[model samples]
Target chain A: MINSIDLILVLILLAVLLSLGSSRMMALIKIMALQGAMVSLVPIFIEPQARLSNGGILFFQLMLLIKAVLIPGLLYMALNRIAIKREVEPLIGYHASLLVGLGLVMLSAYITRRMGLSLPGDYALLLITAITTTGGGLFLMMSRTKAITQVIGYLMLENGIYLVGTALTKHTHNIYLVEFGVLLDLLAGVMIMGIILHNINRAFDDVDTAYLEQLKD
Target chain B: MLEAVFCLPLFAGLIAFLLPVKLGRGVLVVGALLHLQLTLLAWLSDFPPLLPGYFSTAPAGILVLLVTSFIFVFIAPYSIFYMREQEMQSEPIFIGSMLLFLGTMSMAALAEHPIVFWIAIEATTLVSAPLIFVNRSKKALEATWKYVLICSVGIALALLGFFFITLSMDRAGIDVPLTFSSLNTAAKHLDPLWLKIGFIFVIIGFGTKMGLAPMHTWLPDAHSEAPSPASALLSGALLNCAFLGIFKVHTLMVLAGLGDFSGSLLIGFGLFSILVAGIFILKQPDYKRMLAYSSIENMGVIAFGVGIGGMALYGAMLHLIHHSLLKSSLFLSAGNLLLGFGSKIVAQCGGMTRLLPRTFVSFFAGFLGISGLPPFGVFVSELLILIGAFKAGHPVAGGLFIASLALVVAGFARIVTSMSFGPSRQEILVPEQTLRIVSPFALLLTSAVLCVWMPEPLHQIIINTIAVIGGTIHG
Candidate 1:
């Protein structure tokens, strides 16, 4: 029986593919926002045993706001600030990257079955989506030249890792506090990256990482 | 309380961000002094955790905490003088970020819970990013970007690794609280397959931050581009915090009877880092970048020492202490040279023996100390690790280790010699100041003193730290 949890995981996998194939920076950020909102909802649906205490509900709301709204909003502001509306010239082409994204799903499924952990219900789907999202995010980082897009890549990577954490660990531990800390770190990391991105734009007149090659040995 | 060690710096840092520039400088120094005092107090007596699940002091962590605090005490004062000479545009931010970086590192040292440790480690990366970009040059911007992006990605993998460990625990049907101490106690019961997988991720993740090669691409750029005082802290102190993360997980692997697998992996990465550092150091154009590569090499040596276990693990602990002291001192000396000549390129500025004699003395002494010569703690530690490698039946790795060390020394000597004595007569920009000169000398002296005679308590602490992994001082 397919449930809402499995549905959310599949949507996440689709978001990963869209992010990889999308050429415009603004569209990539939007995909990340949608992926973030969906990934944060997985924990609530997957664990039927975890009755939503007051704290848990509050935690989920905060996670939703930060992951869905606050982070993408910051990226949106950063994009406007840079005023670079041109298409990204990826090292790998959009079609090729989309193919790679599809490949990642197949590879992740192979790995999930090979591990043979016997996860209950559709949790295996959660694992596959998690791995594919992570791999796709990494691939995005390598293929893109612009720094802002790379940061978007990082956000995807982070969301994927969050899914992995939710899938593997039991919620019996008072994990809210720890998870909250991780979220805070992610928010701060994005802010810091935004500031640096602004500076990079100011200095080089573009966020192309190729301009950053001056310091290498 | 244990919490105060970190809390004091976090608050002081926030205050420093708002205070006047002069006042911020004072807070930087005063904050370091107070932090050292609290760390000493924590060392002398037990401070039970305010939050038992998140924060606690273990022997190894306290050792790292002490080293971090001791180095900051000197670097903070040195930064005031260094920044004044540079006429920094963002003095308050630099000062504030330094303090915050200290606080985050202290928190990482004290973190008992796995997630708390990850948060602290990740926070360190975020806070320290500003330190590298304080100069605001194009190169500095590039360095800061790479440092943030690479370390963040690497550390995120570490979070995944922690999840795997927790998964292992769930599979074993054990329900212990998620702390390193608790994990160590229940380690023998963990499924070896998951445990092994987790160890690989943790090492690679933390290893990236610790400046192991392949992942060490960011270290040289960031270190050389930062203001020298910030570079000193990044090289001397920050790397150790990352190493502590790997060390904790390695202890668990050993307890779970998977030492051989983890140890071999460590040895491989360690030797590779040394080889990589040696190749880059030989033709290195920038003096600061050369020092940064040397840092990578020393970190490799420490990793190799710990991986060989037995006496080598004991040597690794000693190496950790001396490397922080000696490498930081070297960076401070490099800072003085930068101020004197206003250039990072070695060929552009020369005759340091004539133009900047005081800096030449400390710089030359630092070169000797770091090269593992006599009267320096690194010498003793490296020797012990070498002997242990042979005794532990890793003679081939031992031979590769010595070859890499020789290559590193040869490259290092060429660079240092040219800088100190190579023929050039450029006018010095800023003459050596007493305040600028004292800290490096003091740090080098501490390393030298420890080499000859370690205090009894420090020796005992080193013994306690290594013993958890079956390391003994006497082979």
Candidate 2:
């Protein structure tokens, strides 16, 4: 039987896959929300003996709220207002993207095997998941044409980084205040992206970033 | 006191947002003055950080803070006239965001801890996005989108790099605070491998925001699309704050005895950015975009100088100061040209000397200063960098540096001559104003003055800033 941490990692991986394969904008947002929840939960389970303080607990809750609820809510609101039904034509096809996602996971696994660092138990899997998630997020950003979809890609990348921070660092260095600052910055960044998406939609009558090509040299 | 230097801007930004447009403009200028005063106090005194682990006024930080504050003082008043000329609808947002951008950049400058520094840099991207989007044009929207998305993604990688550094400490069992000072002291004991990996990501991450090439795709668009005053702040001040992040990490690498590795990386990125900017600047369409590319090239010069170390590191710091002054002045002048010609394309703008003679003077002088002509600080700085590069056994990089500089100057000369003398496309749309003309001239004059006579205090600060990397003015 898989442990709770392993189960969560699997779920997170599954969310990344779903995000890449899903064409519907709302479905991708849901995958991101799931990934956010799993990412925030990783710190709690991965360092069970660290004994989080009251402030640490509160920080995690705030992270959960922002990552899972507030950011996705903003994206959802943007989706409703802009009314873009789907990412109809990606720069890369869905099938090629899935293959790329698989290749990324395999590559991460290979990297983790060769690194030969003395990490805590199960950290190899954590590293692999983080790497795959990051690569997949970047791939999504490059392959998608829609502005909202690109934002989702960015969120995925951010979530992957959050996982790396959790897997690699010791809990002692995890100052609650600093972590909260990072969370707040992420929230503000997403909100700003959402606002820009609204403006992009209104100006061009579509959220497709293809229209943004007019600014080039 | 250091807190006041940043916090005052935050408070003023909020008040500016709430107040009417006219009063908001006053708040911006007042906030800039107060910020400059506070920065002077912070520079002169040794005020402990209110949040001890997070923020401090280090030598490098103070240099950047002084530049940011000084530029804002000029850009603030110039923005008043700019907004009036453009007849901007979101005047309050523009004013508020500019002040807030100042606050965030100041925080990035003052941040001591790695994660705190990352957060502050990321916050700078968020606060400054609206400034790029303030024009509400489709192009502005596109630029804002790229700025926010590219910078956010790049900085996330930086966050990952920060975690890697912490991992190095954890592996080595070093329990010191995560501030740059503490990290430097503990560098020798830390794990070198992870530290190297961390430095690479931090460079790439912060380098993107600093407008270094390969990751510099977002810069020209954002810089050219934003209003002139906002463009001035972005090109002049924001990029330096990002450089401070990379510089602090490079200091750690130096302390860890991995200076050669980090130095080579900087030199590589630096030279490549110069080459890219040089190629693009040739036959560039938009004058604002050309200035933006020039900003990239100057940043490349600084990085190249710092990487060469010894006297070149001193050149890098000098380049940072002079570039900020000259480039912002050029952008401000470009703003005036935009108002007069109603076009950003160089082909559409001609006979600038006859059309807007005062702006032409400032613009021409700014172009000279940025191109490293004599009597400008950039000339002295670039000369030192080349000399230091040769002395440091980087003769090949030094040669390439000169080639790139020549190419840039050649491209820029063609544009300047054509813009100043070529046939006019249309009548001037808006007459040049005294307030608009004064700021760019004043900024160029500041660069010229600093070139001829460096103040003792500022000279000392530059020495202190580069001393960690073995930078000395005298070979």
- Per-model TM-score on C-alpha atoms: 0.99, 0.98
DockQ of each: 0.91, 0.89
Give the C-alpha interface root-mean-square deviation per candidate: 0.7, 0.8
- Model 2, B96-118: lDDT tens digits are 99999999999999999999889
User: Candidate 1's residue-wise lDDT over A22-92, tens digit each?
Assistant: 88888988998999999888888876457376478889999999999999999998999886754567899
Give the CAPRI class of candidate 1.
high
The lDDT leader among the candidates is 1
Q: lDDT by residue for model 2 over A107-131, one digit each (tens)? A: 9999988887676665778888998
True contacts kept of each: 0.93, 0.94
Candidate 2 vs. truth: CA RMSD?
Answer: 1.3
Tell me the TM-score of chain B in each candidate: 0.99, 0.99
Kindly report which residue pairs in candidate 1 clash with one another.
Answer: none
DockQ of 1: 0.91
